[model samples]
Target: GRPLRVHSTEDGPLRAYRVYHSSWLRAAVVAVTFSHLLLALIEPRAGDGESYYTSFGSRANEPPDAVRAGLGRDVLWAELVMLLLYAADNMLKVYAVGWGNFFSVAAYSASSMFKTEKWDVLRIALVFAFLVEVIVALSTDVAWRPLRFLRPLFIVSYFREVRRWVAVCVKMIPKVFEMFLFILVVIGLYAVLGNLLFFKSGFYADEELQNFDTIGHSLVSVFVLLSSENYPTIMNPAFFRPDHTGSVWYGLYFFSFLLIGLFCLSNLLVPILYQAFKHHRQRLALKNHVRERRALLAAFQELDQNRNGLVTLARFTDLVVRLRPDIKKGDEDAATIAR
Candidate 1:
């Protein structure tokens, strides 16, 4: 017998060992790929048949059979694309873990399994799901839009820890209402007093002034006092002659109510307006911060190669090194490259 010769590259024993070991892996890859392709084919069947190719083909004059065939082809193509995407996604999951880790693998596997089950009850389930999602999303958006505009103010309030301050203000609302009621009561009191003293014929007959002999005349007297108008005409007997004596006490009482009601009540609105203005300013600042942060994030993401969330120091260094080569070649000027 000739001497047995062995080649270094040929591992007869190991090759036989690998045949058994690699078989399951190769089978899984092929199975996943095929399943993905099938899923893709099925997905396009769900399309509305308004794809670009379908639209293009419809423009031409053709027999019914040809047009129908073309439409079918488009549907099949879309389904195939979807299936490929599905298969690729599944294959990546399978590659990440061996079949022995079935429990862990099951998590990623559920999407395809759920989708398959969903298709069985798709008509009713999909319609309901879509409607529910749309309604919920729209409702949330409607609720959020106004609040989003007021976010800056809300944040400022939070930062200042002003809930207690707001509570205090809220507590004062009833007191403010009571004060308003008091002002109304004072005005009514004066209106009635003036009507009795000036408008009644019996009261006016004894007074020297004949001017204050009507309801209209008494109302004018009350208006002048409420406005803090202290003209001597208000006290003259010609103004309220026959009905009653014009006392200095009337002017003093009317002026007191005017000062309390008009001046003090109007000043109360200042704090409310100040709070609103503060919130507006805070909101503008927050919006500017968000815009700036978004721009910075977009710039960083543009340079991210792997699409992982973080921009690493290594990635930054690599980008700088790559730019240096371009600089050396004068492909980009320093000023332009800086941007």
Candidate 2:
């Protein structure tokens, strides 16, 4: 065999072959360009509401309609881009790799677009929408079997950029876990103090500590009070009892602590929980991903006969025999194999 020359130039044929031959790379370019165009067209019309769509609203009384309308527009544009990419990908596969391979490659390419920022919104949405049209078109049913093979190809799209993102997230996971544990500790402390000082045996027992029975009970009550809009009503009657000065002081202290622990602490935990949940889910996904990659690597290694890192049929048969010890050598020889 002639020596295979490597090129360093960006526009080299090898680079071009990798780019054009890769369904994912092509889909990503298309998906991102289309998403940006769609976002640019729709974002200005969203006005100040665009900011609200990306972040949780600070204002408690903000109308649902305003929020929903803003979110709906962004969602619509995202879906539009996804649909366009799906159609383009299908068409390209049909033209390049025949109808039989179209579903598989298109499914793979669509999965690959998840790594691109332009299509990331759609990708995240798809996680929640797996039972819906997008995944069904890509991965479910006999008609979509080819799509299953392409699923692994999507990982390639993430190789360069996602590694960096994963690295940052990996570094932050321990810190986030520590913060979450700290919040849990604070909640535990509050429960213990609230029970011992206020609920268990105190002067304000009848009023301030009416419903609470134990430390656990008081903690539940505190959680309820913090979450409720009727907290002010509950507090006013208990704290203002003219007969007990102790009740007044206890109420004031409880209310102050409740505000800090429930409102402030709970709100802070929201983002931490979000990040932790994301990290855990991604960890599970990464584990499964590694397993799949290992299987493919094993298959490739088996194909490399003569221990030369080059694939051939003889090595593949040896690997098959190694994998299936139950089959006799005669049966293995009789098995029809593809080149």
Candidate 3:
């Protein structure tokens, strides 16, 4: 037989969060987020990152102007409309939260501020997003089209970890940018040095000069060297050729660039990412723990025979013994478990 049912209060405190508290509403928000994400995924950027047109190619043989005829024509305006919807949704959430806390606010507004802070962050982010969208929408430059791709942020509202992942990326940007600057400086410095050393070694220098004569060319050469393409052509003259200086230092130059530019910079990214993922994992573990605790309590509530808080030991014993006949009443584990 099933365990007795009761309205015992031992289950837990009321789980009445104001925003997205309704299951149906939460599901709706998730569905909307997924739809927005799908729209974002299908909409391809115009060639060279232009914004006005995109493709939803169903076939490789589709015409070039396929996007201009279909979703691309209206996708831009549609995105703006979606942004408006998101803003309105956020606004409604704020209103609901405020009203839910109205009575408590009258009594102790300062202490009760926690209730609305989540919505406040949401509102601010949405407002900023709206402003940026409007600016890009009104702009006439091709560059602004790429900014439209940022619409995927629509998913953040539905997924907590996505939001935190973005936050961590934002926080790590400064350090990562600093590393980028360091590498840029290294490339520029090496480019100059290489051009000076190899720019006009001899008559053969002209033949050897694919990307080492000018500053811009040297920059490209250094970048290409990092990729290690046609590397033997660049180094052979400096070391093996008879008219060459025969100084093996060119090997050291390229080697050091590979060492500092590629190796060191890659190592720096690992820890920042590790810390972010570790923090999110810990958060997920805590979230799962609370959910499991609630489920266990809910199951216990189903077994509680009376409306009063605790389930008596007699009911627990009867329930467990019936559920598991192998565990006799006299077994110490069963007795302890029932107690």
Among the numbered candidates, top TM-score falls to: 3
Q: Tens digit of lDDT per residue, candidate 3, span 1-339?
A: 112221222222112222335577677767766766676555554445543332334433454465443555465556566666666666554444444453244424433322343434654586567657555644642324444555555566457667667766676666467666776887899999988877776523544345577888788778766666766666565667765555666778877877876677657667756665677668767977876676678767877858687888877887777646578877777778887
Runs in model 1 deviating more than 4 A are 1-244, 302-305, 308-339
| Number of the candidate with higher TM-score, 2 or 3 | 3
Ranking of candidates on TM-score, top first: 3, 2, 1
lDDT of 1 at 102: 24
Task: Give the per-residue lDDT of model 2 (tens digit) for 1-339.
Answer: 111122222334334434444677666855554453354343322223233233223343464355654654555446555555544543442344333332334435523311123233333343234225334432321122122233222342324355445655677768577776766676567667666665544433555443355776666656656566545643554566566545555666677767886778778867876776677668868976875776667657746646787776555565556445555545645254423
lDDT of each: 0.44, 0.49, 0.60
Query: What are the root-mean-square deviations of the candidates from the true structure over C-alphas?
Result: 24.4, 16.2, 10.6
Rank candidates by lDDT, best first: 3, 2, 1
Whole-model lDDT, candidate 3?
Answer: 0.60
Backbone clashes in model 2? 2
